[model samples]
Target: MSKRTTLQIATYGIVCLAILLVPSFMDDAFILNKYARYLVLGILALALSLSWGYAGILNLGQAASFGLGSYCMAMALKLRTVPVHTGKTGLPDFMVWNNVETLPWFWEPFYSLTFAIFAGVAVPVAFAMLLGSFIFRGRVTGVYVAIITLAALVVVNLLIIDQQRYSGGFNGITDLAQLELFGLTFDAYSSSSYYLIAISLTVCLFFALAVTKSKAGLILQAIRDHEERVRYFGYDVARFKTFAFAVSAGIAGVAGMLYTIVMEFASPTFLDVQLSLSVVIWCAVGGRQSLLGAALGAIIVTGMQGALSESEIFLESWTLIMGFVFVMIVLFLPKGLAGAIESLVDRIIPEDHAVQVKSRAAASRRGVENEAGSP
Candidate 1:
């Protein structure tokens, strides 16, 4: 492997090791739970990086998939909550208060934990597929895509809030039971829950890394840089875009489910426009082109946000402070923190090694171009 590739692998290894070791050093359940949520947000950032960074498809409504998964898991866990929390008919308290006589037909399947878990991922993938079919196949691109996605998110958020009887309105679903699997309980405040989030984020980060290194991933990036050229090269641009979008949605869905577990509730705010925008900022701060960078960006930003919000002096100005930080980063580090670090590392590497890596990259680009130009 090249020096650059080796460095990347080492970076990933060190980061993963640090994450796995966090629980070992932190014994406070509250702190661990907070970190777990940050990790879950990291997964969401990774999802955005996969689509926006790699595929060049900026989905402003990414939280829709996340919120869907959150509600799906919340529904299952709500059913498992203590009987006292439910109505006489064993319906969610919100549904009971809204006078839901029987569980909606759509909600029946969520009673099965297995099905709920499956749906948490499946539903988002399906939604992405459906939306992508129209957005991509219709040849939507650039800011138009962003507008459509944002509009879709608003619609979904409104629907959830309007259908309070079914969706629990703006209040969302709460009184969730601890997640039970294989006879083990995952309490929100327990170490086990933190591990679950960490493990899930690790799996997602690696999975995304693998995807970006695959043949299809190369084509996706090529399309991102030159969509027309890729289409001329006989590649189905729409298919690749849709596939990336769907994969992003699936990962976001998984993050959402984990969020539900950590927070012990599902709130419409999970689908809020602000949350989706925050995700984009996380990806930008971390270096969208790098999965590990994006994930770490999310974790760091979220941790800072939590700390700032808790500080008596900064509590009221934390949002503005974060905005200023983002602007500064954009101005000074256009490629983001990851890119800046990579540049520093490149300067420290032997000149010969750097030249070799650049030559190989140029050769690879030529090879791709030559292949595309061939009959």
Candidate 2:
């Protein structure tokens, strides 16, 4: 095995170990749950890493996919806990308040927990596939892609808000009951929920790492460098872009579902442009090119945000502060904190393999610059 690959394996092993040990070191359930929220967001960053980092698709509507997943899970859980007469099938309270006697056809399927989980994942992937078919096949690239994604996010968010009676409107789906799987209940403030997020993050982190390290990942990177070149070589560039979009959306969908469980509610904010941009910022600050760094960026930035919010002096200005900090990171640490760590590792290791890793990374950086310059 190559030394570079070995180093990655070692790093991932350490991350897995740290995640598994979180419950042991943190006895406070509240803190654990908060960290779980950060991890859930980390998955969103990882999703962006797959599409934006590997595939060079700077999707700005990831919140739409994530919100769809959240609503799916929220709808099911909300259905179970909503007010219903003694002998009637349960329906969301808003429906009852609106004088609707029956469950909506669209929401009827979410009555089953199994279907909710399926829809939570499938809906986002399906949406991405449809959207990507149009975008990639039509040759949309770069900033146009970002604009289209942002527009889509606004559309989804407005749709959810407009149909307040059905979707809980601006308030979103709330009063969710505990998530029960295999006879075990996941309370929002409990260790079980925290572990659930941890395990999901671990599985997803490695899954993304594996994909990026595989032959498919290399080809995707090549497409990112020059889509026309790959097409000239007889490869279907659109298909691969669509696949990356679908996978990224699916992962974000899962994270959205997890967020609902951790927060015990799903709000329109999940689908907001602000959130979509925040995901991009997290990935950028962490090193969008590196999956581990992207995830770490989400966690570290979120942790600091949470900490700052608790402070009396910083509470009101945290958002502004974060925006400024993000700008600074973009200006100075354009490669992200992960890129810096990569450099540090190379220097400290004192191995010839480090030089090879740096050479390959510099080539990838050049590819990114080319993608940016592409029309």
Candidate 3:
């Protein structure tokens, strides 16, 4: 690997090591849990970076996929608390409140932790694939894609709210039990949960980086820059878009699952349009094109939220602050924070070798000039 690549890898390794060691350094459970939440949000930002930055797909419904995964995990935990093999006994509280005498057929498979896990990833991917096939094939692009995705998020939220029996309506799925993974109990707010989230976030980041570096990554970038040119080059642009969209949605779903573990609940708020748009803002603030930027952006936003939440007087000002941050980043720091940092470093690293280059050029010009003057 090149020196730059090696340095980057080493830096990332050090950061991961530090994060892993956080349990040893911080005894505060609340702070530890907050970091876990940060990791989950970072995963969402990473998803946005992959799709919007590299693939040029501004997905506005990522939160829907995320909510689906969260609901899957939350429901699974809820299932574990109720009686087993008793008809409708394992039904979630909201279902009982809604007079759902029988468990929904779809919720049946999610009773298994493995099934919930699969559903978390698969459902979002399948949905994205279905939508992409139609949208990309029809040559939909730009704002139209964003609008459609936004519409999807709104529709999904409405659907979930309407299905009070199964979805918990606006109250959402809550009072989740600790997760059981292969006979191991994963208690929410536990140190182990923090470690799990960190590991998952790292894995997602690595996978996203791999995807962006692969051959399909090249084609995706091409499509982003010139879809027609890619199509004319005999590439099935639609397939590529669908693939990227599916992968991104899968990543978002994973984030959603982790987030449910952090918050111990799943609600329509998870699928809110604001949630989806917040991710876009995160990606933009972090540098939409840089994975590192995306992660940083998430951390920054989450940290700010935590800070603001502590101040009752400033609670209402948080949104305004976020808006200001977004506008400032877009106007001045086009490359996002990571991009800006890189530019600054490049500027600071003076090109001493330029002296030799300039000397050679000047000598060559002087030699020619001297010869011409003598003649």
Q: What is the number of backbone collisions in each predicted candidate, taken in the order shown?
A: 0, 0, 0
lDDT tens per residue, model 3, 1-375: 645556566666676677778888887888889988987999999988888998899999889889988988888888877544343446666676667788888888877889899999998889889988889899899889999999988998999999888888998888788887767666666788888988887788878878987999989988986678889999999899989998999999999999999899899999999889989988888888877679879988888888887799878898788778789988999778988876675577534578748866866976786588674
Predicted model with the maximum TM-score? 2
User: Per-residue lDDT of 222-321 in model 2, one digit per residue for the tens?
Assistant: 9987778888999888999998999999999999999999999999999999889989999999999899899989999999999999999999999899
Give the TM-scores of the predictions, in the order they appear: 0.92, 0.93, 0.88
Q: Per-residue lDDT for 1-375 in model 1, tens only?
A: 666677777888889889999988889999999999999999999999999999999999999999999999999998887556564438778887898888899999988999999999999999999999899999999889999999999998999999999999989998788999999999999899998888898889889988988999999998887799999999999999999999999999999999999999999999999999999999999999889999999999999999999999999999999999999999998778988987788678854867768867976997898699777
Colliding pairs, model 3:
none
Give the candidate order by descending TM-score: 2, 1, 3
Task: State how far residue 274 of model 2 sits from its true place (Å).
Answer: 0.5
10 residues in a row with least lDDT, candidate 3: 82-91
RMSD of 1: 4.4
* Whole-model Cα lDDT of every candidate shown, in order: 0.92, 0.90, 0.84
A best-first ranking of the candidates according to their lDDT comes to 1, 2, 3
Highest-lDDT candidate:
1
The C-alpha stretches of model 2 lying farther than 4 A from their native spots are: 82-88, 349-375
